[model samples]
Target: MALRTGPAHAENDPATPSQRQIYSQSIAEHYDYRFGANQPFLPSLATTDTGEFINSKAFPTAKYCGHCHQEAHAEWRQSAHANSFRTPWYTRNVNLLMAEKGIEYARHCEGCHNPTALVSGAMTKGSTINRKFDEDGVTCSVCHAIQKVDTRGTGSYVLAQPAVLVDEHDQPIYGEVSDKEILTHLDRHSKAVMKDFYRTSEYCSACHKAALPRQLNDYKWQRAIFLYDEWQLSSFAKQSPLPFYTKDSVSTCQTCHMAREPLGAIPDYGAKDGKLASHRWLGANTIMAKFYNYDVQMEKTVAFLKNNVFNVDIFGLEKNGSRMIAPLGTEPVSIAPGDILTASIVIQNKGIAHSHVPEQRDMYESWVEFEVTDSTGRVLTHSGTIEPNGDLDPRAHSFTNRLVNIKGEINDLHQVWNNRVVAYNNTISSGRSQIVRYQFKVPTDARGPITVTAKVNYRRFDQHFMDFAMGKDHYPMPVVDMSSRTRTFSLGENPATPPDPQDNPLWMRWNNYGIAMLDAQQYSESVHAFEQVARLRPDYPDAFTNIAIANFSWQRYDDSRTSLTRALKLSPHNARALYYLALVERNQGNLDAAIADLREVIAQFPRSRDAHRELGFSFYQQRKYNEARAEYETLQTIDPDDLAAHYILSIVYRRLGMADKASHEAAMFADQKDDPTASTYALDFLRKHPEVASESVVWHTHSDLEAAPSHGSNAPAQ
Candidate 1:
């Protein structure tokens, strides 16, 4: 029988059908649940506090939680948590996996997706025990039961089943506590679930950063999902000072998703000042919410997406005659008929603090939808328009990935098992930017003063996936306009937009554009863009550093040094300026000065991976093998996957008479390096498919723009 510690509330959900009691060891009965060679879940296949399989029934369900947290539970029940496994799309995917690879393979997803079924051993072969926890999905106590976690991810968490808090004798105090007992000793209930680590981003990393290991793919390691890893790579990680924006603090996962709200009708354990962290886990899951008729959740989800989380700015126009660049829609700029225009649009991932889109990029759709029309509303050029069949136009520039298998065929079924290569991925990193230069000719007969409107739009799922799952006749999902900008160009003069608090400052907008150009490796254009930023805000030290970074990449060693000198004058101890000064000195062969600057950078920012890398390289240049080895090793400790650290360590180890360490470093370097032949895979597919290629060329032009005239043709080490 089900454990009836609490008084039943009316009747339980029909989906959670009553069934034969599932004893701890009854599932599998012989051995723990397994997946090929990788036991994806907990080491013990879920465990008691004593390290044995605990009954899934022991974990309190949402209904039990609703006895006290009525409002919170009601909110959670309507969230993605309650429906994670019950959702039709997720159900289809898991069912497909079971049919194709068997239940054992489902363990990989269940570790985070459906832990109750995972820990209960229901994922094993022929385990017919119906589980209440299965319907609960990620229930109240599932998260509360977590005792420890490893931030390396892939559901690297340990759950203690005898309740989180223990008794005086270090024994489980929570296996069968009655509702009266729990209510009387409410302190135990709070301690049972609350831990300091629960507030950390690393705690969320346990499940957010998932990878496809060799055991599952029967091939080399592949990045499957890395939301946490992307966060680490962003400015939010606070490990580097090279980001375009100033980052003052580390970002925890709960910062945005769990924003606190005032207490409602139900009481909460952790409520302070009548406010508590929300359990709704607000995110981009409109597809699930809309399909289930969750109107509140759907509205909240849409509002969250539209809350200035992204920025789309139409910045400059590249004039056809004389190739002059003018700030688009500015009062000083003029537009005329018979003129060819290349308008520059900048997209900024302002709020996400991570990748614009994190996982399985091709599945969820986000793109820049643009249209150029005359004042009379006559369309000139339209891209990213919706088709009659609910699909986006083929020519749209999307924040997605084009991945293919060995045969160069695109996989649309969210099938990671079939993925082989990534042709192109267009996700903007946190506090970063991507530039789109859209070119079109103004027709001689066109009306004057045209309007150029561009919007960053989003959809929860691709039309292809929706159609496959629900058939073509189902209602189409909502298409949200995340961020947008509209500009008007007059025949004689274009007016600039009036200043608004919500809009980015003119200087910062130019700086953002320069940063994007720098990332795109358009050194000359980046230098020009940074020059405008410096002209606009010379007092800002970051502007000078931006100029220096562009110059350094352009191999203008003297110019880089000049910019860094100006930056240092504005702020004598700026780490970014100092770091670039060292790079300029090193490249100019001023070894002693470079070392001194690098040491200062290391002193200020100890975790600066780039500082460590450059310092190691400087030591190696001076034949200081021992010092180089130590710096490289420290760099390795900071980021184990750093290919530069591995490669240099390989050389430095042999120089220091450590042959085995040298060999290991060399192998690690090779293992972490990108596949050189990977580009050919994308190129081959694009060649065979002309439509995709025509659209892709513009999107992939980030790395191929003509370099502006600079110091040297050969690029310096970035």
Candidate 2:
């Protein structure tokens, strides 16, 4: 059975102490948190708390690694992950952001860029470390410290404590993480189970997606985070049976970027036929990497990106510029009469890592441009192109996102400084293919041959949006065309045989294109795209439901209502659409209607925290304390670590005249223990704002750690 309560904190909850810590300390007598319970069997090392006797030298430093693994090391030296902290491009931008938002905000960027130095107590004002931590970019320790990975889209991880030891059973163990050979001298120490989540997509997401405190949402930092959520809403997730797409789909990040290589030494762990994961860690960002003189890594990254990309399949085109790749509104291949002629396109994720447009977790991009043409190469319908001002054509089917600035201005230039992406559509994950469909009436005067040309395009940033953000002249963004395909559809005596829905190219394009429109905030365009989706896949409730949301957001109230009705008629228990319907009704001033919809939403998705939270807020507005409290309490059970929920619960308790309950909830914040980096931030923030120290609970000193009686406890390092 699942545990009915929350995780026990060793120092915070005095009633119970960590058993793992106590047991290990008793066995070792002079137990050290850095080493395992049993010290490694090393002849040159002394143990216990006060004594250390390791004089033998072993292992190679990064310089020595360059001696043998020179090629690999050279590639790593220039990547953004390497110079993340000190690159001039980042330096100027970071400094600008710091001057505007203060030091605490800047830590968000530095956290990922220079994690080692940031963690090692560098990064103070007027600091003197340049290029020191930039040697390896993402060094060996950064990845190794990944103790746990959370699979949820929220992207949370547990970092491992740094400790290196040699074999304790075979030799005396000393605590120090210096060499790979030292691993053999260490005894395995297991604590809380380290699940596979650590190695999955969620692991990459922790730093990839970020959010701002509620107070800072106005600054638009929330848009900077949300890459993981983008993928979750993609067709990849819709069609994926497993957590990630399997072979029929393209391989994911683990399959390509971190592909296993032959292990020459440690075969049992990951060496299969002498193969283990290559540590090259290459991806996009070629220009920036090369700018920093890290061409080797950039070359590898460019090669990887160039080789692995989506594959396209085309059927045939019609002379009137409309192509009939398959029959619309049917699955598999069918010969139904009166079916609207459809063009089908099959897009397969062949080699890209994670998403097709990787690292676009923030900038909202990834699109395919299509131009149906005559034999003379005359233009037909075009979607996704750069306008004169260098922003994406608003009406085109393209990857979309909102652009906002610090001053609440909309920026269309999509430049760096002014570019604050409010949304995006780059959700295509590795190893997944989405079929798209486009329908056009066959003109009786159609010519014999038709050509459909498609191109996969990208832009570094939307310059127009950027201009709005920074209110200054900006540089043009670099554009890259990834892949393209063309095929001639020959007119036949009878309408072309309808291709299977699974193999439909039009649907494939539409599916991916719809994602782009949604990302770009072309709500009406997305709804129009979904209309085709609904027409093609009428049985799929999500197609209609999503369209309803698009319509609602665009303020087409009645149309949105009708679409929701149709969706419910198709799948009466679609909790998602029902919730959307409720939202629409609430926004339309039909409180009762919204309540009815919420009731249905609750019935279908009982454990939905979003539904509960929204409904609780609704009830609380009506002074329904009991109802609001019940919902909030339920939410706490569903997500106990949610400090926001606890804070809200405190308010509810106060409203109910439960002072003790409110005090307890408020105290949770008072006793908050800052993480290493966070403590440093608190110290600095308090120094600047002494008044905050008095008003808010602050924990940021050595005395704070010492006051915790359990500080010296010896817990197993996992």
Candidate 2: lDDT of 160? Answer: 33
lDDT per residue for candidate 2 within 368-396, as digits (tens), equals: 65555444444434445555565554433
- Model 1, 241: alpha-carbon shift in Å? 1.2
In the range 480-564, model 1's lDDT, one tens digit per residue, is: 8888899777766665656545457877778778878887888897889889988988898888888889888888988988999
Residue 544 lDDT, candidate 1, scale 0-100: 86
Off by over 4 Å in 2: 1-80, 98-105, 129-131, 146-161, 166-183, 186-197, 200-202, 212-223, 231-273, 278-283, 288-402, 406-452, 459-480, 483-651, 656-718
- After the best TM-score superposition of candidate 1, give how far the Cα of residue 554 lies from its true spot, in angstroms: 2.2
Off by over 4 Å in 1: 1-52, 162-165, 169-171, 248-250, 321-324, 471-475, 495-502, 586-599, 612-672, 694-718
lDDT of 1: 0.72
Candidate 2 lDDT at 332 equals 30
TM-score of each: 0.86, 0.53
Record all residue pairs in model 1 with backbone atoms less than 3 Å apart, i.e. clashing.
none
- Among all windows of 10 consecutive residues in model 2, the one with the lowest summed lDDT is 699-708
Give lDDT: candidate 1, residue 636: 67
